[model samples]
Target: MTLHRFAFPTAIHFGAGARKGVADHLRQAGCRRPLIVTDRALAALPVLAEFRSHLDGLEVAVFDGVFGNPTASQVMAGAQAFKQHRADSLIGFGGGAALDVAKVVGVMAVHEGHVLEYVWDHPQVRPIVHPLPHFVALPTTAGTGSEVGRSSVVSEDDTHVKRIVFSPQLLARAVFADPELTLGLPPAVTAATGMDALTHNVESYLSPAYHPLCDGIALEGTRIAARSLRTAVAEPGDLAARGDMLMASMMGAIAFQKDLGAVHACAHALGAVCDLHHGLANALMIDTVLAWNFEAVPHKFDELAHVCGLAGGGQAFVPWLRQLKADIGISGGLAQRGVRREQLPRLVELALADICHQTNPRPCTAADFERFFEAAL
Candidate 1:
């Protein structure tokens, strides 16, 4: 038997009003001053103001420099904001991009070098010797679940290649998963991010890594997303659907601690090369990659089909995913989404470089990646 370690350590406050407790939680932890790391767009919204109202008694500063995908420069700027305001804690207050930047702000603030040097692949990757600030997350969208994750995916400022900073210390001290915060998301964003949650569950379940705990979470997360995603997108005000999607998003994030597969590999490539939204990239590539991945893990596909309520079992799973994408407003292929044929070579190369596919049940080769991109296109 092989021995594998498992941990589920983030404290999550889930419900309609969970954001209301953030100030008290920080106070109890002796965090009087906190930096709210978020994007420029979210900063201009009323939601930010409303969330800030809950922290009325506490000293709060907002860092709204995060835009596009999280980047090295953004993390550096956020760290500067943290020092400038003398923040004792961090509140990640937007979508995945903002939350990813928030997770590493403290690393740059207290550590010795540029944020890229801490990436796991760096030749002299700096060790995370000191503790990060007291970080809490309040997600304004239901994707990536960066709030509960122990990793941050920040892109290089120049090349736009995504680099991951992984450490247990990056995990948020607590997560306020308030579905109300997601109720304002546009239909297109809801569709894309919901597909991202579904893809995480699907790909994690398909990964060959040995982690039954993650397998169980991934299946249930798949079920929840299958049932609730369309409703959430159609009726944005439906708190129940929004809440289920939120739970599914976090569950997918937790389950992926077992790691991911080719879908993520392709999606990360698209994010880096085409400047695509990570969630949308996942949405675009999931069915194509899963269709290619099916024969290698037929039993797993059958299990996924069962949970997703597809009567044709394994064979129906991919078709159902295709329909779901169309139903939720994510129609069309990669080409329709602005991916050019000339970019295919670079995408394949980047996909091959991404670490996510190492755990894929079907071992992916360069030729396989090229084929996957062509098929998706």
Candidate 2:
């Protein structure tokens, strides 16, 4: 095995009631005024009020206009809110969408251009502004691990393209993973996000990279998700299960720095065009993509099958996934989720452009993506 270096930049605090540490983290970071970016649903929750009360003397402004998949306009609105309040830091206090938008707000606020100007597709985009405002991410979901990641996903308004914003500076100054906050997440959200975590782990393990550490993390993360996600979803108040899922989620993000593959590529395209939930979309395509990529790395699946406690080798993994999805009430495929056959070609083109495509185990062409989409449908 080749030598590889793994870097984890963010300071993480994990457990029940970890949200209580947010104020102190802000104080330590020397932030007096911070912008709290979240969605309207979360903003209205009592947890948000409690968090605000804890902030007491610290000036905290709320921007709750973020939607399912954050848009460029939403980032602009968040940036405006940050600027208007003269926020010295950002508190991302919800799921992946909210955190992504908050990271974008931090990036665009200090930079001297429109959010679209820094989009990945823009050839002239400069490196993100350095030493951006202190970001403190508090994850209310048990997945997405946006709290620890250096990239943000923002959608383009005109073309509906979901663009990835990459910058090491976008990583949080600190992360608070409070399982108590995740207790109120709906069962569907819990199941979908958990599968998303599973996808991250699986893809990272399959990545043709030299990062043995990431491979180990990804394998163990998959085990945690397999053992705990169902229990977490079934018994929302189970602190142990929630904590394990939280760890698994963070591990999923960290490990995927090695790479993600075709499942994410396809899911990103679906999210761009159909407005489907990111995690659920990935869940729907997981089995199909796994089957497609099986030939490239069969033994990895065999190892995963053993780790997941399934019966056979590589083939056992797919059935295990199907059973898990069924138990979680995730029974539908892309067609059931409103993806039409006519959309395949366009989605394939978009999937091909996704950054995740670069790390796929087997080289995937437009035709390959179409076949995957059709098989998934």
Task: Report the number of the highest-lDDT candidate.
Answer: 1
Q: Residues 1-377, candidate 1: write the lDDT tens digits.
A: 77778899999999999999999999999999999999999999999999999997899999999999889999999999999999999999999999999999989878888999999999999999988899999998887988889999999999999999999999999999999999999999999999888888888898898999999999999999999999999999999999999999999999999999999999999999999998999998988888988999899999999999999889999999999999999988899988999999999999999999999889999999999999989
In model 1, the number of clashes is: 0
C-alpha lDDT values of all predictions = 0.94, 0.89
Instruction: Write the residue-wise lDDT of candidate 2 on 1-377 in tens digits.
Output: 55566787778998877888888888987889999999989998898998888887798899999977889999999999999999999999999999999998998888888888887678898777566998899988877988889888888888889887887888898898888888888889999999999999999999897788889999999999999988988898888988888889999999998989999999999998888898999999999888889999999999899888888788889888999999988996788999998988889999999989789899999889988998888
- The C-alpha RMSD of each candidate to the native structure, in angstroms, is 0.7, 1.4
Candidate with the greatest TM-score versus the true structure: 1
Q: What is the Cα-based lDDT of residue 4 in candidate 2?
A: 64
Q: Model 1, residue 231: displacement in angstroms?
A: 0.3
